[model samples]
Target: MKLSRFGGILSAFTATMALGLSGAGAATAATPQARATGYVALGDSYSAGVGAGSYDSASGSCKRSTKAYPALWAAANSVSSFTFSACSGARTGDVLSKQLGALNSSTGLVSITVGGNDAGFADTMKVCATDTESACLTRVAQARTYIQGTLPGKLDQVYNAISGKAAAARVVVLGYPHIYKLGGTCIGLSEKVRTAINAAADDINTVTAKRAADHGFAFGDVNTTFAGHELCSGSPWLHSITLPVDESYHPTAAGQSGGYLPVLRSAA
Candidate 1:
């Protein structure tokens, strides 16, 4: 499939680390261990760390780097082996089948980052590039309606499949942070559109969180720790519109450290 024109530049720059701890407050301060006795990763570009910095040559997928949260979390906690099946542009159904299907009795820990592209956040930006906030908001509202109706059941099915595959594994469902702030800019769109996008992101997180709980999986809310730290806010976790290398609607390297890392750590 041809890369979307907006995301093409980011694809060109695709590329993408860790620590440990100990303490009296060991539960919090101590390094959280990977649930996987045998690790396996799943999901999309964010999980793959597409624009967060560097690519893994062996992975042969754009911008999939070692420093991405999954790899970093695994190394920090000392997971000796893992299989990462995360790919750019993956949807939940794709994850359930292609990524999760690769697992078996040996798999222990599983993590996933998904739902945004399925909600068409990226596609909305493409259509609203020359439109008004009202136009974009309309698009967002429509998208949300479609997503809320469709995604929950889809997420449930995926989670159930994972549970069946690795009953002992800790399934981590990583949620998205605010892609834009209350009011932000880029490519001529308005703050309202950004807010709409952020709100929609919240919706995906909410549904995913519920699904995780239902399936006995861990839910990681990256947005909570990143409160007020959206892409428009000077020290944004996501990339600025002008940064050609940063994926059009994704996080930057800083985002991986400031945003993604915390979410993974919280899971620990």
Candidate 2:
């Protein structure tokens, strides 16, 4: 009877040890990689998600949205510690002073979307409306030149400022997503205007990409990633001008999910 009791105890102990080993192996296999730490977002209304998303009442701006790209990126990636300093009217200068404050050595990621405000693209569109294609084209060309010359240096400032504050953090500067496509048209637009705007956007992205590269930051080209989903195509990524005007030019919820999330994931 004593020998039988001892054998039973020995079998149970062996089984417990085997289970522990298996559990440890499974944990090792399932462990998620320790990615970079806190995520910091900076920029303008595009980053803010002004017109088409849920605003955070606590953020003290019509600009800050809970559904904005930064928020979405953070949620999707399970990044709990995030600092989003984006505001609706933010410009290049705005970022250097205000946004850089949120970054520190513990920060792992920084994402920015600027230059549109500096170029005054929104104001130009407001003035030109959809009817004045020639004026629109002219304004776009002038803005392109200004951006090409001025934006690179400003981008360098943003990069340097961020690096200064958060030496180990990876900086990512996102390009504008395509709001217009070749031969596309809106309620007040002709095909000519659409082509010109699309071309100008491409030029803007080119300058942004080059500047980001020079500054040793990652360039998130959401423009190329969203090539087929421009507003005129009836795609959900961008809003068409005639009907849900608020969402026009800005990225849609789908855009944030599909377009921007990939960039954040890659940055990590």
Candidate 3:
């Protein structure tokens, strides 16, 4: 299958990480006295650290950022071995086919953020960012439909696959942060459109959380972790609309460190 054009753009936006850390509390997990020996990261651009500056050249087209939440958490926790397989535009299918090869019995930890692409999240965002409110609303409506109708099954399939491959690994499924600030103004995006986008995010999280629980995987809620620092907030952790477009609506490095890292660590 040909990659979605928007997926390529998303990949480019996440190719680097600009470092800064502030706001949000540390995520609390039951830290074992013996740290995990092997960690594997799986998911989409959010997990790959798209808006964060600095890509790992070794990761090639996946554009995995060295400063992404998974890498940061692995380093901070001193996990002895780490494999960052999360890609820039991965859907549930991609995880099943491409990313899961990194997992095995010895894998002690796994973290992922998926299902958004399967619901066409980037396409919705593009419509909202560049088109009229009506068009954006239509796109969001489509996304919500997919989120409700198809996303749960897709998430279950991926989560079940992960469980099968890494039975002993503590799996944590991460959700997406709200792309816009609630009750706040952003350039080009009207209040209604922003609300629709955020609502779509919430819908995705709801299904993802439910599926994770069904499969006995931990669900990491970044919504609470990212509260007060959404795009256009006083200290926004997510990048607002930007010139290159790919840079728009992704987590800044600070978001990965402060917002995502803490929440994922607490869940892990």
Task: Identify the runs in model 2 with alpha carbons over 4 angstroms from their true place.
Answer: 1-36, 78-80, 184-186, 241-247
The lDDT per prediction is 0.75, 0.77, 0.86
| lDDT, model 1 | 0.75
For model 2, state the Cα shift of residue 46 in Å: 1.5
Backbone collisions counted per model: 10, 0, 8
**Candidate 3 at residue 228, lDDT?**
88
**Candidate 3 wrong stretches, greater than 4 Å:** 1-36
Identify the leading candidate in terms of lDDT: 3
Q: List the residue pairs that clash in candidate 3.
A: 14-50, 16-52, 16-53, 16-54, 17-52, 17-53, 17-54, 18-53
Over 41-144, each residue of candidate 3 has an lDDT whose tens digit, in order, gives: 99999999988979988887788898999999988886768999999889999999999997877789999999888999878888877788999999999999
Give lDDT tens digits, candidate 2, residues 62-98: 3687777788778777553898899877898998877
Evaluated with TM-score, which candidate comes out highest? Answer: 3
Give the TM-score of each candidate: 0.79, 0.80, 0.84
Colliding pairs, model 2:
none
Model 3: residue 258 alpha-carbon error in angstroms: 0.5
